[model samples]
Target: MSAEQLPALVVVAPLVAAPVALLARRALPAWMVATAACGFSFVAALALAVQVTSGGAVSYALGSWPPPWGIEYRVDVLSAFVLVLVSGVATVVAPFAWASASAELERERLYLFYALYCLCVAGLLGMTATGDAFNLFVFMEIASLSSYVLIALGRDRRALLSAYQYLVLGTIGATFYVIGIGLLYLMTGTLNMADMAARLSDISSTRPVLAALAFITVGVSLKLALFPLHLWLPNAYTYAPSAVTAFLAATGTKVSVYVLLRFYFGVFGTRIVLEELPMSQILLALSVVAIVTASLVALWQADLKRLLAYSSIAQIGYITLGISMASREGLTAAVVHLFNHGITKGALFLLVGGVALRAGHAGFDRLQGLARTMPLTSLGIVIAGLSLIGTPGTAGFVSKWYLVLGAIEAGRWWLAAFIVATSLIAVAYIWRFVEAAYLAPLGGATPRAGEAPAAMLVPAWILVAASVWFGFDTSYSVQGAARAAALLLQ
Candidate 1:
């Protein structure tokens, strides 16, 4: 295959490797297959990122068929950015699965875990890379199905309930998305996004087009876990195996957000979605409520994992709020926050997992005395938590800063105040963890256990270190986000 074809290959490699992983079964051979597939996929994503930065945009028609007639795999700066996030997390999480799988999943099902992971990763990659509307739905299903399986494999019996709930809600979301695609296809007779965009420019004011936009917006909002529709997120994240939580926290909703951006900006165009309709107002209202309500709920969670799950819903609100502002600065805030928050939450969840591995649980009551025993891991958690609060000189600060700027640019001083107020709410929840970990005495009265294995600690540190590293390095995120925002505007 040519170098230009690597985007398709990057997605296909894991897809092709999944069956190999399944064939390897639960033996050490299965681990080898996972490592190989994840490793190769990681490299392919890096290569695609490099190629996109150097070459502008990359597009490959499936089976040598041209656009509007055949499926296309396309990579631009934004898609490449998400590809890196998805594949990179999968690569790091694989080694983590080695230690974590036995603790939380059936030994015989370990190979199946990696196999489904690869499928999920491939589906996300496919969703981000495809230029066809129908293909996006197909890939969305691939990812969502694998996600349900991954959630169901958690050690806790409650994970089954969580998985079933997510399955039902996620299936409804995907079906809605498909129906929307069907509406678009019926109206335009073409599945290609660029071709649809060209055709949509001609008759976007029509009733069919407006209905199609409404269907797609609601569908994507559900998929992305927007407020009032995010009931499935907390239980799913809280009960899922630690490795699954880390991977999904870093990638799943982010990909859904990318799909939202792709459809809103790339397919339907800005004027129709932002100006003609009341989407921005609806998004703004929900985002504000999500930020306030979710953060408040996070404060009350007794379980650390559940707390973080609620925090994720709040963080998603920040991302969507930026979108609601509909300015270049606002979109930049959203895009940069997507990457920044991923690293922060990934680090935090990994630390939570490590805590679970050593202490046998991750409840705040269970984690007392950890600060003395698992010093480094606890510190990592603290650092990530600080970032979550948008503490100065962290990655989270940069995104939140841009968001505040966007609010000011939109001349909404109320939004700026609300942003700060919600951050104070964040401080409350983060302090709840900090106080429990550092100040509270041991609840069990037993001596603290040793740290988690090096496999888990190292990966957690990598993400934590990245959170700190990216805070000071604005050139990469700033330029990339700006380019992506500009591209969306165009």
Candidate 2:
């Protein structure tokens, strides 16, 4: 009820609703409970964002215990921005999930899907809000476990394999993260991030602290699917249920990236990681490799979901590229792209899901002539795809513009050129779908499928429209990212 409690409530609303939804024991009722909870969390996140933006950081100590000893829910510009993005996506995805889940899942499993969805949302929100290191790992597991189950609910048997692979890798990542935090706790005797930062300042050059940095970087990179570590993502996205893919593809990795930012800038400081250890060069090399390799792989994919899966990897490369620059503008670019790419990719995946609903498959072969049959869905895909290519007057362009500027500001002209050049690969992959839908003729024997149900179409288009709206009006995405960047750099 109090403004001070908004941060905790943002996570608690969905956490409490998960079990309540499960107890409902019916799909419709469970869905209503989940949706209501997500909506409430979204509102709380928005209010928290407003408070942080207007009044600066808001920290709430759990159980009235003072931190270093107590877990803290800290809302600053960066975390608040991410909180809004995660909760906002969950709110929109909740309505769209009803139609897609009912069609893809068994009646008995539908309620379970709703319950896991709430858990995932709660976990993501908690991860963003928490200011304690161990608390973050706890929330990360909550989200990761729920996500594994959601992916396994896919119709194909491969879904089980994909989920298993993700579970294995995700657990490894979490374990490494805990080990890193344990080392930090040993050095600082504190699990609170702010306190850890203060204590680490004097001992950052020590071997244990450096090892903690390595462990945390690799651990978070694995979770965020940073290139050579991205083996679990494509299959998981490819085999997962459409709604699950849309939700995870949009919010999951973005939150991981936020964690990386929190540790890199907020706790460890850029001087230690970026300068003292050559981390920027290492990140730059990996990011370039990810962009070039993943985009090329995406161009050759036969399945639409897999192509987008690879595309997500390439887009993440762009975000990391910005981070590697280690400039205020570069971090701002990374933050902006994190939000923009989430909306663009979310829209694209949701549209693909709509097509899957009507056509039963998202492969290029199945989607041939989709423009003629599922006109609205195809149109939404094209628009979102154009954004992916960083076309002017789209959300993606705003981020890309700042990325190029960041490279140029950092005196990396070649990097700027490479960024533009890699975008051509995006064009090629996007054109694959365009040609399949528009150029390929419809088979005479194929049954004509109409557009997706309004429930799905509306949410998909909402993100598509957001892509364009944010493109033209840069106030929220761009300016908020600038403020967030300033806060992180502090």
Candidate 3:
């Protein structure tokens, strides 16, 4: 395909495959279709990233119509980087879903699961790639609605409640986002992001524009699970099927964060939002609370999945903390942590699926002596956990290093100290699992079980290996993040 066609193909491929998977009506065939579609999308995303990085931004107008009159898909350094991350995680998680879904879902419902999974992937890609504000909202709903169905497919009855809760909150968030976009449209007479950015500069200080910014920030914060608005996340993730949890945890919130970045820096510019308004201070304060409070809450959780869910909030705080600084190093830290945390949490959640398969649950009591029973899976979790704690020579440490440097560059010594202090909280929770798996002996009366099959183990370890590999070789993530940061600030 030509470079111009690449952006549309990235979204269209998986979107077309969703209906095909649903029509297949057979579990294996549906899974094959979904996996192949995701793989194709990942390749397209990588191609788009390379093209944009080498050739500058790529914009494609639909039906040969140009921007401000026709819908356009734009790919810059930031959007291209996010496209690769979302598609890459979806591709890695697709094969592993087969084994995990077979175990959790009924045979009749397996095809439906694959169908929704494809739609979710397509929606995330579309949201990242679109240049129109209305188009972004459309894609956001497509992903969110599919996610509700996927979460409700869990074996547990509470999955229904979690899905319902997410549905209600998600709708509110989408509504707020639409309202903000509507206001922007009234002010600028355009829905294209680039056009909106150009027009917003003329009236950015007006009351309507400031109100639009407020609505958008609150709406995106709820969607991204930013601190106090994060009530929907833990239960939703905890009750969803393991594969669903892993996929959503890795890509869903990250896309929302991407939206925040696109609007805050790309459309509105940093000066108005970060300086004229109180967004930076508000985000910084909430991020600190999320890091400290969520980590403490995670330390007391009995269920392993729920523990990781809480830890996800803390990690997201780290990402937003970097963004709140509004400096070059700060934005780079945010982008790098977004990728690193996605892989680290994805690896951890995938391993939790293994624990759920063999132990029948992921509670700490059930995980005793798992090191002896599921050695490879346990090892993967340990390595991922170390990354979470920001141990040196791990992917997590690289992001933290940049974050601290950003803090220091801003002359916020107290913020730098707070970052280190919260990392210790991560250490406390990680050690909880380590102690349970290694020191606590298995009870003799417990049922016998072995390691998860190769399908699940392989994908989980691929991410685990990536955590170490990216840690030692930071060229792709660090350099891409720096370039993306510079482009955003320009």
Tell me each candidate's TM-score: 0.98, 0.99, 0.99
**Model 2, range 331-442, lDDT digits (tens) per residue?**
9999999999999999999999988887776888887787898889989999999999999999999999999999999888999999999999999999999898888898
Local distance difference test, candidate 2? 0.94
Model 3 bad stretches (over 4 Å): 444-447
User: What tens digits encode model 3's per-residue C-alpha lDDT throughout 1-490?
Assistant: 7778998999999999999999999999999999999999999999998998899999989777999889999998898999998999999999899999999989998999999999999999999999999999999999999999999998889999999999999999999999999999999999999999999998999999998999999899999999999999999999999999999999999999999999999899887998899999999999999999999999999999999999999999999999999899999999999999999999999999989987777888888887888889889999999999999989999999999999999999999999998899999899988888888898552225788989999999999999988899999999999999999899
Q: Output the TM-score of candidate 2.
A: 0.99
Cα RMSD (Å) between model 3 and the true structure?
0.9
lDDT score of model 3? 0.93
Candidate 2 residues lying further than 4 Å off, grouped into runs, are 444-447
> What Cα-based lDDT does every candidate model obtain?
0.89, 0.94, 0.93
Give one digit per residue, the lDDT tens place, for model 1 in 1-490.
Answer: 5788887888898898789889977646776777777788788878888888888889999999987798988899999888888888888888887887767777887888889888988898899989889999999999999999999988788999999999999998888888888888888999999999999998998998899888888888888999999999999999898998999998899999999999999999999999899999999999999999999999999888999999999999999999999899999999999989988999999989988877666888777766877889889988999889998888999999999999999999999999988999989998887788789875673237678889889988899988888799988776788889999999
Judged by whole-model lDDT over C-alpha atoms, candidate 1 comes out at 0.89
Which regions of candidate 1 are displaced past 4 Å? 445-447
Which model, 1 or 3, shows the larger TM-score? 3
